[model samples]
Target chain A: MRLTTARRSTLFAGLAIASVAVLTACGTASGGGDSGEEATELGDYEGSVSILAWPGYVEDGSNDPSVDWVSAFEEETGCMVESKTYGTSDEAFSLMKTGDYDVVAASGDASLRLVAAGEVAPVNTDLLKNYDGIFDFLKMQSWNSVDGVSYGIPHGYGANLLMYNTDVFPDGLTSWSAVFDDAAANSGKVTAYDSPIYIADAAVYLMATQPELGIENPYALDETQLAAAVELLKAQRQHIGEYWSDYLKEIQAFETGDSVVGTTWQVIQNSITTGNTEVVLPDEGTTGWSDTWMISSQAKSPNCAYAWLDYIASPEANAQATAYFGEAPSSQAACEFRDDCEAYHAGDADYASQIWYWSTPIADCLDGRTDVECTDYAAWTTAWQEIKG
Target chain B: MSSAATPHVTAGVPQPRDTPARRISVFLSQHARVRLGLLLTAPLFWLGLVYVVALAALLITAFWTVDSFTGQVRTEFTLDNIITVVTGSLYQTVTLRTVGVALLVTVIDIAIALPVAFFMAKVAGPRLQRILVIAVLMPLWASYLVKAYAWRSVLAEGGVVDWMTAPFGGSSPGYGLPAVVITLSYLWLPYVILPIYAGLERVPDSLLEASSDLGAKTWRTMGSVVMPMLWPSIIAASIFSFSLSLGDYITVNIVGGANQLLGNLVYTNVGAANNLPLASAIALIPVAIMIVYLTAARRSGALENL
Candidate 1:
């Protein structure tokens, strides 16, 4: 009996270990498969498309009855829309790898990773009619394209602008210095965006202030440049009242005067009812994000996914979507559908040029340097923890 | 079978029904080891699968690496992530800060809970005790996010704390480590109080009266008698507060100013950075800490109270 019990226990242990091995192997094996090939021509609509998108991007009237553009697309294309919202790009990345989603709205940070992992296929712009109307400046960027092959359709873009309370800065601050070199002026009332990506914001500041550091791209930071940025952030950390990842946290902080100066999005500034705050581009430019709509490599509904890409990029749908999300629309024609387009500087290439869109930092330097290995996202994460310490 | 021939059966009494339940009881009573095994099987399987296996998987993942560009987990065995977590100054500092904050929160909770629990368990009348218990439990029913956000407003500059303290030339601590500690203490207070309250209830009132009747002062009675008996309870309560505080990221995110704890490091690596191996490695810190804490608690006989 004792020998049999021992044998049974050994079997159970072996089964548990085997199950773990299977689970781990599944994770590793799912990556880098041939995504088959990009569709050269559209077939019949598969009658449905499963969309994975940022919140408010693919509204189907489920959240707010009136704030939906998806219904119209569904009606016109005869494609049933089943959508899931992800809170962050990382979540969207993992969700896309499940091969459950037909189309994904990927930010620059997630787009390249998806492309590299073969989770998404390249887009043939010829197959999309609305692709032509997208802003020229928004097209074929490093984030959305690799080796000149476009991977997705441009959706919307927004910058992380510097916002300050008028009560704190009566004369108004003109530079990112207010949050960096002069952050001590505000002392414990200053705030900043809370993310590893915010490390690029500090790098952006360093590029303008200390040009001797030879920092070119905010996203492309070699070991030494990243160290410089980390040091600068460590200094700024002393004055930060709090770092906010949630928009509501920042808005409440501003309203209560706990945070008098911080990086904010245009949407957050608009949501502040007190009118005591204002957002500026600042002299040093800013970090921003641009989203793209890409079809999953294993899309079950390729035609419908293509249809979604075309439909969402159309003028009226794009206007409603971008306006609701508080970002500049992807096209000049989209601006024609809304009166407040000028407020977001829609279709303005010059303003867009001043924004450095968020991109996943990799060992391969994004700034086209061949000599030094740039720091990756993991490194930034480590540095961010240290900075916050 | 004839009733007259059945041994140990009463001649006049009706035979007990030989139903399924009777058979089951008869079988279970006779095979004691089998019955015990049957009773434990489901829970043992649940515990093994959900806790042990999941933990083992996490530990295995910690030794693996990720392809930085693709965010894909590479299952090849490598100690790089664990090594980084151990040797990295960032992890060390965050771990220290986390432990410090957790300890402070536990101490504060204990300090607050002792008096309140003493009142509830000893001083208060039965009706009042019931009311106080209900009141202590009321906050737990509300969503945790709601409470954290409410505290955010309460601790905001020129908000409730400031408005109240302004008369004394003081101000809100604002969003920072202090706010984090304060909010966490508030959040875990009920957990601390209940354990201590239950412990206090278990101590006989007659014992307290006898101590006093023996010519001991009230403070002397509490210090010499009540406190020593309360040690296990205090340790049990401390376990709750300490582990809860150690694993908290959301409360800190809401009010911790620019601070990041061990939780935040784990969260950032998992959610934002998409580095699961590193996150798992960072997560081991709190698990290891809690293991040590639980071991110490066990040594002090706190597990009995639990």
Candidate 2:
């Protein structure tokens, strides 16, 4: 049954041709869906408003015994609310694209892509009465706006910090390099945010050491910049005991001392501190991501969506949610309760100066790359998969 | 013997050709009730129609492409989506690893299961067989996710394994590969055991006694008499274990750590990255492999039966 060389070559040629035909057929089929941008029809209001939100964004209806945000919103605006919690921003984007969701709380990274895809609509800021109270910085942020059309209202934000088990490193953590570069001390005991977007951290680390890599802004990565960052992560992955995405798991990893040092969100740090860990703002400054409440283009009830956005961004709601969720407040008026908010706020004059907020990379942005010239979300995703692999 | 011979003779005889009315009477007499029953049942008719057509439609949708930026299913033809399944190095690695792990799990199941199944069918009392069946089914009754997470703590640095091995200086117990293999085998063992038990149950006691009467050794008698009878069950169980493990993502993801499988890739791509097209494409690789394996296994079983 052994095939001759010529026969094997002929068989391979046939297979190659058949594979090409299948790919060509797929290409044609994919193009067919691109032709029509059928106008989104509204007024499916009576059924429900399917919202994809962060896990803690919705109160646990059974345990918390609070008037659920959805129930309260439904009572106020009369649009029934149906919500599903998402573990990551990437997951929310996938679900929202199905046209089954009416609203989503997209983060700074995902909001633009959603707008570009027309999955989410540009919020009429005027319709949102409480939009005025939202911090000016969050309102016109580059990721949330495209061509002066704002797509989302400010929601929640938290800084990514260097967290360590207080028991393991009582000396107090100071730098990102201690975890990324100096691994002998913390070998197999470090974890990081298991995200491709964490290339920003690598860029942060490289900005200090490999100055020639020319990485200034972590998010604004060029192909060359990305290649160097990818190499850094490939090295870091070797040191990581686990690349954790879940906050609860991160806490568990920290509490068990399995992960000694990690790049963590403030909320996760807060959770871990309840155990034996302490978080430190790195000497090199820290990076943060802001979450935004965006309305879907296919929203069943715009009035209700606007109401919910306004209610959430109001002084009382913003202050309460920020205190509860362990993120910075989204409202200016909420800062009047500065003493109460200080524990959660990363923006106290000393802390504010230390944290660099996330800004979308656009053409001529200070992150050292032009918008169109920089790597977009798709490239980041593909690179992330490759990096993890 | 005369009556049985007469019946065979009647069956062998051909009926004479007849007129249209007579033919109608003959066909009606043979199949009228069964045809009427099929026609009268709307649910069965619909089930048959949907099973054939709807499930095919679902499988076809996996070929559909989703826009990376927008996350829209581009109903257009594009093999660009399937690039990973066809050519990606990581996917190839995962695919091979999944197959290897699945084969290992199947073999482990067959080794442990055959004896247990034999004991239940041939050796155990009726009550004992029932009790053993209950014990085997107990693991399947627990929540699958709960079972997987339970293995995590056991594999953790200072968890159960480390504690036990500490006296022997097995410091910093590594549970990555070992944990995944053990957990997956545990999860799908029932898939093998149940089928093998059923197959062994089908073997007549007469066959085993005949083999023994012919002065065959215990091992030889079991092999010559039992294995051939159980070939179909072994094939069926292999198909179950192989297919289940091939497509599994959760247990492996929780246990495999950096050693990613096709399931983990599909999960991260589909859930974490929102890259459905790529996920769907990667999903098809295991599916294609499964189809090939199952078909080959089925054919071999049929040949063995003949």
Expressed as tens digits, the lDDT of each residue in A119-162 for candidate 1 is 99889999999999999998999999989999999999999999
- Provide TM-scores for the models: 0.93, 0.83
Q: Which portions of model 1 show Cα errors greater than 4 Å?
A: A1-29, B1-38, B304-306
Calculate the i-RMS of every candidate, to one decimal place: 2.1, 5.3
RMSD of 1: 3.4
- The candidate maximizing lDDT is 1
Clashing pairs in 1: none
What is the fnat of candidate 2?
0.43
Per model, the share of native interface contacts recovered reads: 0.76, 0.43
Model 1, residue B253: C-alpha shift (Å): 0.3
lDDT (C-alpha) at residue A181 in model 2: 74
lDDT tens per residue, model 2, B52-106: 3343333454566665555666655566756656787877777888888888888
Candidate 1, residues B30-110, lDDT tens digits: the string is 999999999999999999888887898888889888888777788888999899999988889889999999999999999
